[model samples]
Target: MTLHQQIKAASLAALQALYPEQAFELDQIAVNQTKPEFTGHYTVVLFPFVKTLRCKPNELGEKLGDYLLAHTSLFSAHQTVSGFLNLSIKDQVFTDLLLHNFNNPNFGKAAPKSKKVMLEYSSPNTNKPLHFGHLRNIFLGYATANILKNDGQEVIKANLVNDRGIHICKSMIAWQDYGNGATPSSTGIKGDHLVGDYYVRFNNEYKKQIAALVSQGMDATQAEKEAPIMQATQAMLRDWEKGDENVRQLWKMMNDWVYEGFNNTYARLGVDFDKYYFESNTYLLGKQLVESGLANGILYQKEDHSVWVDLSDEGLDQKLLLRGDGTSVYMTQDLGTAKLKYDDYGIDQSIYVIADEQNYHMQVLQIILKKLGEPCWKGIYHLSYGMVELPSGRMKSREGTVVDADDMMDEMIVLAKEQTEAAGKTEGFSDAELQDLYEMIGMGALKFYLLRVEPKKKMIFDPKESIDLHGFTATFIQYAHARICSILRRENLPIMPDSSHFQGFVASEKLTDAEGKLLLSLEQFPEVLKAAANEYSPAIVCNYAFGLAQLFNSFYDNHPIAKAATDEKKNLRLMLIVMTAQVLRQGMNLLGIRLPEKM
Candidate 1:
């Protein structure tokens, strides 16, 4: 067994032996290598066993520490404070774990047999171009899937497009009226952005029509009816539903353009999806489910003939399944999508990465799916994260105030390029080289900034703070890896270690504080990965990367791996440094961020 596993096993064995009838089950054995004002390389907690042991906290901790030290070679010394047992492992044991990591590149990705999991996010509407908010959703969804896959779960990444809606018809109406020959290229705008502009233009014209009617002393409802934009949009929707050839062709054309633009951004961001679902296709499928529900009497029709499900007892209002005119609502399409996914993927679990604002809607979905007799309802998870708000307030698309995703990416690239120029790294770089590096740094910064925050907490997106790459940022971590590579290159070391050189390396009693701490941090990576998987939190991995980088920086400031007096100690330290680099790379990969060889 590995050293960590051995340590945990020894600890567990002692606990079981000391309290024979206490039914001690090991929950977790963390390595809190740092104490507030103490001396220890690892602190373990035995609080969970206190109830069964029926002893005071201090007594229980002391007994466990005594049991572990006497029975196991895992710790050289240990102490108990309150209910916590702080144990320092033998230096050789810690070094052995580092060597193991150095040998195995995929140190933290081990797992049992994998199971299938479905993940869905980035459900953008066809009416408008994707914006900065969609970037958050896409990044989280993509990163979560990577982490789960790394943890040995088979993941299916998917997205849903809201294609058939009133908002979409607004774009179509404006295109028909004022976009006779105005293509995206002709107007020097992206296809999705161009279509979205027309959507905004339609609203503006409709508002003018409303104002004109209001001046004529008409009420708001009358003014809305009198507006030609509304009439045109309604006519387009009718034709779209009726499968009119001209309308279908135009819809396909516009949707293709928007999708092309979306794909380009997705490529740049290093995000991908295994499948796509469209509301146009799923809405009809939902109508079928609604019909089935009505036939089975699981759903009832109101006096107005609108199909509704009563969930009032669950502290939720009755929700509509189908409108009086038989049009499917948002819930209808989601219900259909869930059923379809069961047949297509048979996922063991399905997670939806959505904003916390839709908590109510998702709850309703879960309940409705259960009432509909779907077995997978119990397995559906709404991985709700809080909003990414600006300093001013939340973004509202209807007000034309949402930050466009493509524009934001372009701006980030520009900023990255400017930084590269200021750093004087662009002197010998070609345009192609500059473009590649800019994309890496730009998207890396963006993804890291979003992933570093706790997914459920509301975060303020400050460009000024995010662009600073010196501390706890993607560029900082990437720079650490690059620095290691530069030093290794100058020394002409092999990429992989020489096992002959690794055996019987001499110890250094004169190690610096930072080197010791960094070595300690390297040993906790496997445990960190396991914790991240267990808690379903990418922020755990992010925090680990930040801590590792900080420790490595400290070591670089104090110790020189290249100029050490002893080759044995120098090679050993370099091995630890390489192991640290691998951990950072692996962690960043789980968050869907890449490391550039140089910066």
Candidate 2:
């Protein structure tokens, strides 16, 4: 168990012993790190017990503190202030924790767990390249999966590609009408970007058609419905659904180009999926499920032969499953995909990393699934996150105003290079080494900035602020790691210190304030990892890493490691910094960031 857990357990025991007639659980005993103004390492709240036992706050605190000091060697002293019981842990405990885990790389990871999970994210369409708005969703999902896996959960990363839809057909129609047989190879453009251009063209032409119809005395709503491009796209969708050979060929060719482009982007982002579900493959299964629901009286059929589910009793409106023409909707494919995932993996949890705009849709989906008596409905979890906007406001994909992911990455690399040169930190590196270092810092900054915020809160992306070396950014942590590496190399010490190096250490030796603070922070790494997993948020890991780095910097500034007054002190500080570097590396790795030895 971690130090925090141990503290909570001990507090529970003490409460039970003091008040024999009262019932207490471990979770009820709140334990938090003592504030800097206090004189302890951890503090337990005494307010809860005082009200229950009808005793004064300070009196109850004194009883509990005295019990802990007399019964366990965990704390050396205790202080009570305003109903808070603070306990100072013994110096030997911190020394022992550092000695036992300094050289261990997997110090914070949990053992394998029995529960299985499937995380779905980055469900991009085939009509456009991944833009800046998609970055938050992608990074959050990827980092959360890594954190969960590190916490010992069996995790499967899945991606559901929306490869078949009318939005895709809009791009195809535009390309067929306007392009003189221009391909990605012929136009010297990325496949997804090429398709995106045609998508924009389609919107532009559609707008002109609408305006022309309106000028001819047609109502605006009628003009939108009667637009030639819309009619053509609808007809193409019908043809593709009917298995027309020519339409299928065209659809396959365009989707393949988009897939190639998407793979390249995913590789650069360092994210991959264990499973891939396509809308084309799953929509039929959804139709069958709808038919079954109808036969079972769980769903109703309209007069036009369309499928509907009345969720009025569940506080939701009627939902459409299929059109009168037998074509499926987005909900249909989603239902099929949910069942397919459960059938394939039998996972205990199915997490969808979607934006908050789909909150109502997800709610209706779960209710409908439960009405159908599907077992997977119980496992459906929507990890809803808010949208990522820019300082300039929201982006519109069809109007081609969004920042492309590739362009953003390239810009970050250039900015990194500029900052590295300005700081005069690029000395002693080859051309190839410089390029790799730039990519590491650039990508690390991007991912860290996006993941540092709580998932449910909307954020604005500012490229310049994200790469600041002195701020709460990945660059700060990466630089700290590199500093530790530089120190170890200059002292001719091994990066991973051996236990024998600290053989002269005495457990009874007193610790400096800086040393104790650093050790305390190091001992909390395991607890931090567990908290991040439980909350399903990478922001927790980000906060821990940033705080640890800050503590290390403070420790180094106030104390000298290599030039300590005693050899024992030197060895102790060496072990502390080495373990700090190890933890920083592991923590950043969970966020898909790489720390270089020299930056």
Candidate 3:
């Protein structure tokens, strides 16, 4: 149990003991970190018991505080302020915590959990390359997976590739019409980029065709439907569904190019999937489910022969499952994929890391599955996040205005190189080491900046602000870790110092305000990790890491580890900094950020 949990448990026992006739639960006790201006490590509210016990707030706080000090060694001192009982934790609590876990690598991680989770993210379409918008989704999902895994859940990172549909056909058709049969090798462009160019090309031509039809006096909607490009795209879609060999070959070739490009990007991003589900293979998967639904009268067919489910009773409109031509819709494929995931992995939770725009769609998906009596419906979790926009505006893929992920990464590295050089911290490093450091700093800045905000809030990406060393970015945390390492090296101390070095220390050893605050922050790492896992938010972890780094910096400035006034003081400080570095490393690793030994 965490310190907060332990405190609550202890307070409950005290409350129950004090009032034998009145029943009290753990939830009735509210424990929070003491305000910075307060003189305690944690504060307990006394208002809940005030009314029931017919006692004043401060009176009740005194009763509870007296009970705690008399019955337990948890608190060294207690003070009543207003209606709150602020308790200072015993110095031995922090001393033992530091001595036992300072060098433990898995200090904050939990043991194995019974539940398994399949977290699906980065469901990128083959039609275009991943853009800046996709970065948030990718980082959130990846970091959440790591957090969950560290929290002891069996996590399967899954990627469902949207590698089919008219969008894919659009690129193929464009490649055939406009290209002189140029391949990625021939054009010296990344395969995904090459395919993405055609996707944009198709849109450009599609707009022109629409404009020409409108100029000839056709209604805009009719012109949109009757444009030659649209007609050809529709035909190609039908042919592909009907198993035309030529169309299938072209589809495979283009999707292959996109996959190769996607793999490279995923590698550079340091994310991997345990399994990959392709839309092409699973498009027709829901047809059987639809048949069963129709036979059971749960789903209805339109006059045009398209199958649909009426969700009006569930506060939603009718949802199409299959088209009149018997081809599956996006919803249809999603239904099948949901079942496929459960049948394959028996996951207790199926988390979909999709954007908030698809909130209704995800809702309908779960409802439809539940209506169909599918077991996977209960496990459906939509981790809906907001879109990422630039300072100017949102990006449009069809307009060829989206910021490509590769280009963004390249730019971040360039920024890192410039900042590192400007800081003049590149001494004593070879060319290879400098390159690796640049990549680490650049990628760390990108991931941390994107993840520092709550997932549900839309954010604007500012590259310059993200790499600032003194800001709440990964660069700041990384530099702090490096500073700790430098201190340890200069003092000739082992990275994982022997706990025996502190054997001469006693429980009554006085801790400076900075040392006490740093120890308190370090002790909360596990609790923070647990919160991150439960909330499915890496932002929590980011905040914790930043705070811990800040606390360490304050401790370093206020105390001297190598030249302490006494050997005992010096040993205590050494252990504190070593543990800080270890905790920082573990916490940042959970966010997929690397900490360098030197800046």
Candidate 4:
């Protein structure tokens, strides 16, 4: 256990004994390490228990405080003041935990006790390239998977490519109609972007065609409906299903281009899939499940041939499983996918890293799965996240306002190089060295900007502010790491004074400034990881990295690590820096950021 966990656990035991009737959930107990000005090492708020125990606040604090010191040998000093218990830990124990934190192999890993989980995200359509909106989806999906894995759950990251749909057919049809054998190489356009251009072109031309029909005295709305496109697409699908050589050849060629384009984008963003489910494969399975549901009386078939489940008793509308023509809808494919996943993995939990907009869909899905007698229904989780918006507005691809993910990444790398050059920090580095620095800074800025915000809260991606060096950005943290590395290089000495040569290392009154405070902050790294896992928030870990960097900066401003008067004191402080670097590296790794040694 981490020192923080041990401390919290010890305190909880004492509080439970004092207030037996009070519900002593650890979440209700706030144990904060005391500030530099305070005398204690940690403080606990007793106010939460005051009303529960029906006792005097100060008296309750006193009793709990007394019990803590008497029962736990970790704390060196203890006191009660104003309904709060303040306890100070011995320096030896504090330093020991710090040393152990860096040396322990599983410092940030969680204990594996139970359950395996499957997560699905980034199910993008094939007609277009990934954009800023998809970035939010990708980051949230990846971060959630990392958090779950850190929480000791077996996590499988999966994706479902929307490879089959009318949208894709629109692009294919447009390409076939307009192209006189013009290829991506001939047009000098990226494949996905090229296809997307044709998709937009198709829409513009289709609109004009519909307008001509309306001008000829047709109902405008009815004339503009997708019935024509749907009919053509369905005919193509049926042909492809029936092994028509022409349709099969065209579908394979177009899908290959889209998949290649998507793979390039996914590689740039550092995302991969263990398995992929195509709509082509799972779309038909829903019909089978619907048939089974009908046989078992879980659903009712209407006179019009529509199959639905009446969920009005559950305060939800009746959801259609199969359409009148026996065609499966989006929800049907999802049901089939769920069953397929369970049959494939038999996982203890299934998590869908989907947008909050689909919150209702998941709720209905879980209800249907439970009613269908799926054993794994109880473990289904919808990791619903909010939208990513710019300062102007939400990204809309149809408006030609979406920021492509690859383009944005390239922009960030350029900005990072500009920042380093403008700061004159690239003087001593070669071109290759400078390029490496650029990638680290760029990725750090990207990951930190995304992970620092709460996933469920809408975030504004301010370009200037996101890469700012003065605030809570990844660049800021990377700069701190570089600064420390610089100091260590200048000193050129072993930070660890061979303990075999000394009786013990001691911290005198002279080392009682920000150095002490920084060391204490470093001790909280393991605890930060534990809290991040428990809360299922990468924001917590992101915040900890910023706080650690801030503390290190404060310590560097006041304490002279490279020029301390005594060798022992300087070595101890250098050890603190080494420990700090390790903690920073581990914390940033959890958030998918890297720390460059030189900025």
Candidate 5:
């Protein structure tokens, strides 16, 4: 159990013994970290006990404090103020905490869980290259998976590529009509980039076609329907869905180009998937489920033969499942994918990491699945996150104006190089080493800044502020880890010292307040990790890493680590920072950010 948990249990037992007639539960025992001005490591609120027992708060505090001191060896002393009773941890406990976990890697990770979970993210469309918005989805999804894994859940990370749809057909039709037959290899453009260019071309040409019809006195909406490009795109989708050999062949070719490009980008982003579900393979998936729903009166068919489910009872509109032409909609495909995932893994939970604009869509998805009697419906979870925007404004994929993921990464590296050089910390390095360091710093900056924000809230990406090394950015934490390594190296001390070296040390030597504070901060690591996992938010871990670094830096300024007044104090200080670095590395890794030994 964690330190807070231990104290809480003891405090609860005290309350039960003191008030035999009054019923009590653990919830009545409220424990929190003592305020900085307080003289203890933890505090128990006496107000709850006083209010329940109808006794004076001060009286309850003293009685409970004395009872706890007599019952456990955890606390050294207790002080009471108003309804708050602060308790200090024994000095030997701090030393034991440091010695046991200082070098034990993966110290904060939980025991393996039996229940499995599947987290879906990065559902990118084959028609376009990944953009800034995709980065947020990918990072949030990837980090959340790692957090769950750290918490001991058997996490299955999956990706559903929208490889076949009207959107994919748009790029295909444009390439067929406008291109004098160009390929990614022939034209020196990345595959997804090449396909995305045609997606834009399809939009531009379709708009002109709509305008021409309007000039001939057709209604704008009618013109949009009559546009030849739109007609051809629709035909392409239908043909591909019907398994037309030529159309399917073309679709496969273009999507292959996009997939190759996507692989390169994913590698640079340091995100991966255990399984990839393609729309081409899963688009026809939910049709069988729709048939079953119709047989059971859960759904109805329109006069035009389109299938739909009425969810008005659940306060939602009737949602279309299949069109008149018998082609399945996005919802149908999603239903099939959800089922396929469950059949494959039998996961206890399924999380979909998607944009918040589709909140209503996800709500309908879950409701309809339950109504349709899918067993996995109960496990469906939508981890909806808001969209990402630029400092200037939002991006439009159709206009080819989005900040491409590759471009953003390149810009971050260039900025990293400039920032690192400006800091004048480029003393020792080879060309290859410098390149690797820049990638680490650059990617770290990108992931840290993005993951730092709560996923549900929208954020504006500020390139300059994100790359700056001195603040809450990933670069700041990376430098802190490197700083500790530098200290050990410069002093010629064993960077990874043997735990036995500190065994004979005297815990009664009296730690400076700064040393105690640092130890206290380190002690919270396990709980911080657990809290982050429970909340399914990387922001929790991100802030903890930054705070630890902040605390260590403050302690560093006050204490002499390599050259303390006494060898005993110096050894303690060295071990504290080393433990601090171990935690920062493990925590940041959960957020998909790497901390370097040198920066």
Candidate 6:
């Protein structure tokens, strides 16, 4: 148990030992960190027990504090401040905790729980390259997956590629008509980028066709509906659905190009998926499930011969499942994919990393699944995150207004290089080595900036400030880790000692206040990981890592480590610094960030 938990358990035990017939769970006990003005490690809330014990707040608190000091070995002394009983813990508790984990790299990580979970993120479309919004989704999903894995949960990272639809047909149509047998190699552009160019080309050409029809005396709206490009795209979708050999070959060839580009981006972003689910394969699986729903009379058919489910009883409108022409909608594919994933992995939960715009869609989907008597419906969780807006406003794919992911990362690396070189910290480095460091710092800054905020809130990303050496940036945390390394190098101390040979901290006659404060924060790492896992928020780890780094900096500033009053004090300071770096590395690892040994 942690020190906070230990004190809480003991306080509950003390209260019951003092007053019989009183029942209290540990969670009901409110324990907070003692204020700096108070000479204690933690404080207990005593006001709630005033009426339950039939005693004044001060009187009952004093009685409880006296009992805790005398009977509990957790604390050495206690004092009542404004009805809150503050308890000072024994220093040896902190010392023992630090010694056990000072050199252990996985100190705060949990043991395997043996339960399996499936996380799906970065559901990119094959029609376009990744953009800024995708970067947010990718970072959030990757960080959360790593957090769960570090917490000892078996996680299967999956990606559902939207490789089919009218959108894909538009790009294919544009490529077929406008291209002079061009490929990624022929044009020397990325596969996804080349495909995306045709997608935009389709929009521009469609608009031209619409204006010409309007000038020719056709209704604007009707012209849009009657355009030849629109007709050809629809025909292509139908042909593809019917397994036309030419269309199928074209679809496979184009999607392969997009996947190659996507894999490169994922590699640079440090994200990987165990399985890839294609819309082409899973779109038809749910037809049977929808048929079962229809047979059970849970779903109804409209006069137009379309299929839908009436969720008005659940305060939702009827949702379309399949069209009158026997073509499946996106919802049908989702159902099939959900069942496919469950049957393949036997996962306890499936988290879909989607945007906040689809909130209503996901809710309706879960209800439909539940009404269909599917057990996996309960395991469906939509990790809905907000969009990434620029300083100007929202972006449009058809307008080509979104920031490309590759372009953004390149800009960040440039900024990282500028800032690092201006700092004049590097003494010697080869060109390749410097470039690698630039990428690490650059990508670390981007990931940390994006993941630092809560996933539900839309954030305006500023690339310039993200690489700042000060402030709450990952660069600051990296500098802290690097500082520790520099210190170790100066002292000629081994960074990782043999676990069996970890010499216990010297017998310091007395521990300083700074050392105690640092240890208290170090002890909270495991708790932070568990809380982050429960909440499914990477923001939790970001907050914890920044705070720990700040605390270590404060300790470094106030204490003299290289030359101390005694050898024992020096030993304690060294071990404390080592443990601080260990915790920082573990916490940042879960956030998909790397710490450079030198800045």
Per-prediction backbone clash count: 0, 0, 0, 0, 0, 0
Model 4 lDDT tens row, 20-87: 76668888888887765667878888788788788887888678777877887787777777777788
Cα-based lDDT for every prediction:
0.80, 0.90, 0.91, 0.77, 0.88, 0.87
lDDT by residue (tens digit), candidate 5, 299-320: 9999999999998898778899
Extract clashing residue pairs from model 3. Answer: none
Poorest lDDT segment (10 consecutive residues) of candidate 5: 461-470
Off by over 4 Å in 1: 1-9, 19-36, 45-63, 81-84, 426-431, 462-466, 494-512
Mark the regions of model 6 whose C-alpha exceeds 4 Å error after superposition.
462-469, 499-504
Q: Is candidate 3 or candidate 5 better by lDDT?
A: 3
- lDDT tens per residue, model 6, 1-599: 77778888988898888887998778878999999999998999988887878887778778888898788777778888888998888788788787787887877788999778899999999999999899999999999999889889999999999999999999999999997779999999999999999999999999999999999999999999899999999999989998999999999989999999999999999989999898888889988899889999999888887899999899878899988977788899898899889999999888989999999988988888899998889889999898988777787789998888998889889888988889885568778888988998899988998898999999776543444546798887888888887777676786654444335545546677888888888988998888999889999999989988988888888788878787778777778888888888888888889998777
467 in model 6: Cα distance from truth in Å? 5.2
Clashing pairs in 2: none
Best by lDDT: 3
- Candidate 6: worst-modelled 10 consecutive residues by lDDT: 497-506
Which model, 4 or 6, shows the larger TM-score?
Answer: 6
Sorted on lDDT, best first, the list reads: 3, 2, 5, 6, 1, 4
lDDT of 1 at 132: 79
The stretch of ten residues in a row with the least summed lDDT in candidate 2 is 461-470
Candidate 4 local accuracy as lDDT? 0.77
Error of 4 at 184 (Å): 2.9
Assess candidate 5 and give its TM-score to the true structure.
0.97
Which tens-of-lDDT digit does each residue in 480-529 have in candidate 1?
A: 88788767777776545556646676665444556667777887787788
TM-scores of the candidates in the order shown: 0.93, 0.97, 0.97, 0.91, 0.97, 0.97
Q: After superposition, how far is residue 178 of candidate 6 from its true place, in Å?
A: 1.6
